[model samples]
Target: MTRPLRLHYAPDNASLCVRLALEELGLAYDSVLVDRRAKAQKSSAYLAMNPNGLIPVLEIPQGPMFETGAILLWLSDTYGGLMPAPDDPARAHAVQWLFWLANTLHPTARMLFYPDQYCDGDAEGLRRTTRQRLSHQLGLLEQASHADWIDADGASAQGCYLGPLLRWFALYGGATDWFALQRWPRLLAFAERAELQSAARKAASAEGLGPKPFSAPIHCHPPEGSAV
Candidate 1:
């Protein structure tokens, strides 16, 4: 029998994106919660698989894979869904925008959620700056009509990634008073629809994300692990 994929995750972490991809692709996988309360991600075994000690390591036959974007892209390419195939003319736009999400938007979120990691002091001030940057980033996305991958009408690789991000904007790290999905009506619509899809429903159920996980955000209450 083929080995099933094993996903090491913490509820509502970056791993949530990967989990969604797996579900959307209808791939059978097993979940092994990484205890954030105990910093299990930094444990020797986890570190050996992912030197960065990040959550959501997907263990496959070849080895353990790290990085959510890389995994999502790989899954889309290998399994043939959630992305425009390599030969498709729109594939170029999709690939480029996917990179932008991975390299730009995702890092900006990291800064907002962990400003102290990038600053000397003044973490709150860093958040203020990051929030402005994040706002601009979202605005850019809101107007990105050329990005076919940003399709809101149906599931795509970018949709899977962006859904969790929109959720965090409303609920995670610190004060989310400055954030509102309404500002990006298109994205808000996407979020509302994405949450009702089969993959997201299963993911939300498994992670205790509650119904309407994206459009209406809430802190996760997992059965086995802490979200923080």
Candidate 2:
């Protein structure tokens, strides 16, 4: 067998998606932790790998893979599982959600939680605006989640898959409530299942390495959206 892949990641940020994807794919990979709080991501060594200094860099046999969503697509395609079979409608559906998580939901969520980190403008003003935007997008997320999708219990449900965001919301407070999440048991169940996976739990444990105060914490529209 070939040697395992090498993965450098920071668990406290959006890198969790790639971590979970690797686990689901049963890929053997080594982990390198980046200290987000210390701004280690901006270091020259890391910048050489990814100018953006983002986490969850996968050093595949062919080359380095950056960006979580892109990595997810590559892993699913390269390994063949966790997503719908190639060209299936569900495959498109999976990519739809993945990109929504990547482009719209994830960016919005980060802006809300860490506006100060990204912006040097009025921090309080950014926080207020971010909260409002977050609330509105969350409303959209609840609505879409309640429509229809695969559920945790293997039953059909209209709105589900908001479980990951619900957990984050529950930890942070504000946003919506638990009833909305329960509307899709399988989605919640899926989150729970994925959460319990060894790699995911391990990643969670690694988050503690960030500064002591590092508690971690998205949205869509008239066109409908998902949170990261």
Runs in model 2 deviating more than 4 A are 1-3, 117-120, 145-150, 153-190, 197-199, 205-228
TM-score of each: 0.97, 0.70
TM-score of 1: 0.97
Model 2 is weakest, by summed lDDT over 10 consecutive residues, at 219-228
Task: Give the best candidate by lDDT.
Answer: 1
Task: Report the C-alpha lDDT of model 2 over 8-72, residue by residue, as the tens digit.
Answer: 76543455566656665677788776766667778998787788877758888877778877877
Question: Cα RMSD (Å) per model?
Answer: 1.0, 8.5
Model 1: colliding residue pairs: none
Error of 2 at 49 (Å): 1.0
Cα-lDDT of candidate 1: 0.89
Candidate 1 error regions (>4 Å)? none
Residue-wise lDDT of candidate 1 within 1-228, one digit each (tens)?
Answer: 778999999999999999999999999999999999999999999999999998879998878999888989988998888888999888888887878888999999999998888999999999998999999999999899777545556688888889999999889758999998999988887888899899999999999999889999888877778998
Pick the TM-score winner.
Answer: 1
How accurate locally is residue 141 in candidate 1, as Cα lDDT from 0 to 100?
95
